[model samples]
Target chain A: MPALRLALHFIHRELRNRYLGSFSGGLWALFQPLIQLAVYSFVFVYVFKAKVPGANAPGYIPFLVMGLWPWNAFAEGLARATTAIQDNAALIGKVALPREVLVFSAVAANFLLQGIGFCAIVIAMRVFGVPVDLFALPLALLGFVQLFVLALGFAFLFAAVQVFVRDLSSALPQLLMLWMFSSPVFFARDALPERYRGWLDWNPFTYYTEFFRAALLGAGSFSLSSTLMALGVAVIVFTLGYAIFRRLNPYFEDFL
Target chain B: MQSPVLVEARRLGKTYPKVFHRRDRLRALYRLLTGGPGIDSTSVLRDVDLEVRAGQSLGLIGENGAGKSTLLKLIVGVLTPSSGEVHVHGRVGALLELGAGFHPEYTGRDNIALSAALYGLNADEARAKLPEIIDFADIGAYIDEPVKHYSSGMVVRLGFAIVAALRPDLLITDEVLAVGDESFQKKCVRWMEDYLDGGGTLILVSHSMYHVQKLCRQACWIKQGAVAASGDVFEVTQAYLAYQERKSAAQPVRQDSPSHAQEFYLIDLALNGDTADVPLVIDQGCRVGARVHVHSRDGREPVISFGVARADGTSVYGVSTEMEKQRPLRVSENVYTVEIEFPELALLPGSYLLRAHALDTEGVRLFNTLVRSITIRGESREFGLIRLKHSWPAANSETNVAP
Candidate 1:
């Protein structure tokens, strides 16, 4: 119970820390991603004239919005949480509380902020006559939660490893970039060459983007088998990451 | 009967891995993940057995790097022990190092809330205690400023205030009193005294023996990462002080070596019939006898002198044969011997040095000197170098009537 309270406190602090010194404050959380969305929409919709490969496909901006919000939550959460332990070296060295709370709060804070932005954009798109499935928004949130589980898994793994190998945090951005390109964040799985289409199953993040697009924009269909597979992958990754973190937890102070 | 034990450690020890290179950390991680044998490490603390019951105060005293802080950290659960285990059953408030867990970028007020949460206080409980903490810190508007902007003393004041407000079952502090200004230190000491009086337990680490003696009823002296002595506060502190004194006295003793060319040279000095250079240990108030053999180059009688000093070289008493109008007895052509005895030495329990000096026949030119260390061992808590003779009469007696 105390651990839960401590995690809540850290989450509160993490949320405040992002906006503490910035002029935009909480608005920056929404504005930064919207700007990124605009840049992507300008490049993909206007320059390349990209379109979803279906007769009744959603507009490129709506499709991209659906995929980008969840992607941002996952990527940002993983990035922030990966360095959580390393960032709080001062606290960890002096205070004795559950170390996992730092990682948990970092990931939770990002997902929370991005989750709010995701809702705002979806509601705005619906009002603008984009035909967003507002009723499916609840199901889409479930998809976001699954993605969070996966991100937290990776966060725990990377955070623990970052303590021993500090290069992980420095090298994380490039790795995430490569991962973004590999996943179906910018394009649908159908856009890939027919021969490579089936390989999307291999990228754990592919299921999240496709699931979000299907749930929010009603553009794609998700099968029961794929849902089970994604859930299995999230659980297995979470278990593995948590196990490694627990194994290395006792020795963190030595390395720090 | 004693109160319940709030802390117990059985052979608790800690060792830090030797990570000179970055690669070593990775290798250590790999080994730890694989459940392999331990890596190369340096032990900072070893075989420490300690127990503190409720309301008991313990003072930890040692030189720097003696692992006193490490021991406290282990007990406070900040550091994991490499061997054995330590259990602390009650809430602990620790103020270790400067600015202990405070974040530099956060305001002091925010940090206090965070600290309150870390101590397992709910939001309402924390809010209830907020005013008390702020008032005790007494830094005024600086509470809203970033902790990084505050002075070191201000940081300590705030840290101590937070800990004081919590009033945890066990309080562990490491050299926190040394940083604050005089008034703040007095405030902290007063607070600690009141806390102790209210049955709070404490484990304090300090370099100042005075503070240790004042606040702690039991003391543990750590030397080279191990307990050198432990027991009553007075006895342990006295032993530690004596050890320090012997260390300082060990240096600059070359002049004590006898050289025959001098007009007068002291050949030997003995304390309590023990002539060896090793320190003589005696109970407090026991008789102390000093015998000296002086060698005179001229066939003339020499004046002998005996002096007593605290181990740190503070002079306590000195007397010469010239003052007593006595002369040393010549036993040979050029050798003379003199002896003095104190039937009841008034010196208190601690370490002291006894010196025997040889002067010329005129008692003017001091030629040679020899010294020996003597330790008075007892359970006396009286202050200063000697135990004064006095009597406490009954209040009803005529001696109690004032003029």
Candidate 2:
């Protein structure tokens, strides 16, 4: 219970503190998702003239938001979490406490932004003339899974790897760029030729984006089996990431 | 019951592995063919034990690279020990390096939040106490600006202010308190006194004996990765100074044999009126005597050159062959006395060297050179040349002294 409280405590503090110097204040958290939704909707609907997966998909606006917003939560959360321990090197090396709080704080901030993005999605669906249905509620539970797991896994890997290899900082942005492209945001995964499908199965990010778009849009076009495969990848990768992070956490004080 | 040890260490030690990058590290193909770097071992502290209770404050003193900082880091839990263990019970707050971990882009208020969290305070708790910390720091308008604009002294003041306000269960302060001017240093001392009065555990590391002596009752002297001495503040300090004196004099003392040409001999030096150990002080009116040991091939009159010289190569006083009459004496390896009298010696207080030489009556020089130094410690603004002991002129005044 105290851990839950501390997590809330950390989340509130990080957002408010970051907002202190920002011009748009905490609104930037909401604004970022709104802006990305507009850009992706224009590109998919007007520029390319491609139809979204589901026919009653609440139009392209709701479809673009659901897939991209939660995906941002995962990517942004991991980027921040990877650097969490590195940024708090002072606190970790100096004082005695549960050092895990710093990493947990990063995840908490990501969760807060994810919530803001979720609120904006529901509002967008209302304006687009999409009718509410009971099945839409279940999609949230299913849709948001990739956000949490990807964040949890990537955060652990980046934090652990940062201490051993300082060059990770410069290399990470480029690595994220490549990872972002490999996901099916630029093109539909179903259009993949036979040879590329196997490699796409191996790519961890394909699971996060494809499954999320399927759940939120009710796109029966996305195979439920592929979604399960992605979910499986998230679980296995997350466990290994956390194990490596815990094993290396002890000796952090020595090098740092 | 006696106050239990709040901080205890039994053979607490920290060693670091020195990584040796492969010579072929630049060659990617070689590294791919082979592996990574090799490791070498180095120890910062070895087999150390210490105890500090709630009411006790321990002072750590050592020459540079003597493991003082390393021990402090271990006790404060900043660095874990490579072997053994340390048990610290209480909230430990360390002012390890002032202005460390301060974010330059952040304002003073934002940094205060971060600093508080770093010291184990929560956000709401830190915010509740923020006003007092700001007031204590007292850097008025600049407190609202980015910390990058703050001067080094201002940064230290803010760092000290936060620690002073919290008054944690245990405080481990490094030599950073000396970063301020004399007045600021006094303010820090007062804050330390109040903290100590609250029965807080304090571990202080300082090179200044004066500051250490004023603040701490127990002292530990570290030398070459080991505790040289540990006990009462004065005794341990004295032992450390004495050990330093011996270590400095460890240079090989040159052996001189009696010469044939001129009747000359070199003799050991004495400070004050004592002939045993060298006294550590020198001032006006303090007497110095030299007992010379000489041997001559042919019996001849001994002419001596003696002088007290300052550190800068200026001769203060000389009772030499040019000034005084030569005395006929039996010349042998046995001892002879040459005492130069000073009614009142007036000189600035600092370390000075003593020189003595012996020559034959034919005006031929023989042997020269003396001990390394004689240090003088006295009150400030003393008038000099010779120390005159005189009475103030009143009704019974005989004389008024002039330098």
Candidate 3:
């Protein structure tokens, strides 16, 4: 609880310091992803005429929203977390504290913003007459936790590397963009070629998206086998990231 | 039972990889991960051993880049030593760098809580100490303002305030007093005195010997990453001061006459009548006399100039025989002897250079310079280059006497 309180204070400071000065302020947190979703919708709905396997054109927006919101949270969390140590180099070089607090606070701030955006998207889905299963909310929340754990794993790995290699901060966003496309953020998994569809089994985001889609739309490929696989991969990434982070934590002050 | 040692560092050293290219850093990290052969590293600190008992204050004195800060960091566990080990017995509160852990965007009050938490204070304890920290900082309305808006002195004030409130068993401070204003520095010193009186162990790093001698019972002088000297505060500080003077005195400077000055040349320069090869050293309030021997090509009385400067090249005093209208006493046909005696040299304790120049009788045109180094030793802790003759009345004396 004390750790949580400290993380919360850092999260509050991070959020307020970054967005409070802008004209749109905290609204920008919601607006950025909405704009991205709108662009994706325009390209898919009008240009590509993309169709969901179980939903019509009217239901496709909510399907995309369910996947896109979690992806935004995961991607933003990792990106911010990677630079957490570098952003606080001054403090790290001086005082001794749990360096993990820096990475957790950064990820948590973005996660909170994504939660708000997810609520907005769910409300908009209801207005559009799309399915919104209140019973499936717990599953969606689990999917969020899984995403957070995976993002934290990557955050620990990258944040450790970033102290030595500053170029990682610049290169990671492009890598995340590529990763987002590889996952089923915009298109349905069924739409992929049969050869490539097998690769989705390897992509952990694929399972995460399936869980979220199942919770919101009740039409995702979520089964016991897939859930176990998701949990397995989450544990691996978390453990590996945490190990790498702890191993490299000592040399952080040297590089910074 | 004997109290446990508050801090102990045994043969500690910290080596940083000589990282130039990005690949070198990566290779070093890879080595760290795989437990492979280490990449080449330059040791910033080497073979440093220190121990501090409970309620004892140790001062670390060194010039900049001498690894004082690194030692402090290693002891406080902010930095891990590359070799050996550092064991600290209790909770440590360190003010390593001013405003180090503060968030610029957060209010001073908010930063106090955050920093307190970083210092291992729980939520309730941090909240409980907030009012006391605020009162100590006394930044007035600025406490509500963002930290970035606060001045440097205000930041140190807030930082010292937090550390004061924490009252950790071991306190490590690095040059925190060097930045703040005089009164705030005094306040910090007063607080530290009280903290020591309350049985707090302290590790203080500072360039100022006055503070170290005043606060610490033991002192360590680090020179080029090694322990040059360590012992009682007075002995260590004085030895460090003597070493510093000798180092400055050894700075390369042309002491011989120039090759082109053929008309007249200063053959020799001596201080305090000591013509030996060793440097001249004297105590404060003692006479310092410079003897200059000038050889004249044409039997003309050369205008001999005598000047004294501090080691840092600041000219303190200069005089010329031409300006004083004083004639040099002739030692022989062409060799003239001029002795300038400064009765009761008022120079403070520091290294100084005595320069004697041989010029034409007109006190202008070509010349040659001969230099000699001198050191003044004094126990008086006075400031500046000169020891002025003065006295202060008794503290708060009501009597007004005209003597």
lDDT of 3 by residue, B9-94 (tens): 99999988788887988887888889899879899999999989998999999999999999998987889999999898888889
- Tell me the whole-model lDDT of each prediction, alpha carbons only: 0.90, 0.68, 0.85
Which candidate has the highest DockQ of all?
1
Q: Clash pairs of candidate 2?
A: B285-B345, B294-B332, B344-B387, B345-B387, B346-B386, B346-B387
Q: Write the per-residue lDDT of candidate 2 for residues B363-382, one digit (tens) a residue.
A: 56656445545555553333
Sort the candidates on TM-score, descending order: 1, 3, 2
Better model by DockQ: candidate 1 vs candidate 3: 1
Cand 3, B chain, TM: 0.78
TM-score of the second chain of model 1 compared to its true counterpart? 0.79
Candidate DockQ values, in order, are 0.63, 0.23, 0.52
Complex DockQ, candidate 1: 0.63
Q: Which residue window of length 10 is worst by lDDT in model 1 chain B?
A: B248-257
lDDT of 1 at B224: 85
Which residue pairs come into collision in candidate 1? none
Ranking by DockQ: 1, 3, 2
- How far does residue A27 in candidate 3 sit from its true spot (Å)? 2.0
Tens digits of per-residue lDDT, candidate 1, A1-256, equal 9999998999899999999898989999999999999999999999999988998898889989877888899999999998899889888777888899999999999999999999999999989999988999889889989988988999999999999999998899999999999999889988999999998889999998888888777778898999999999999999999999999988888888
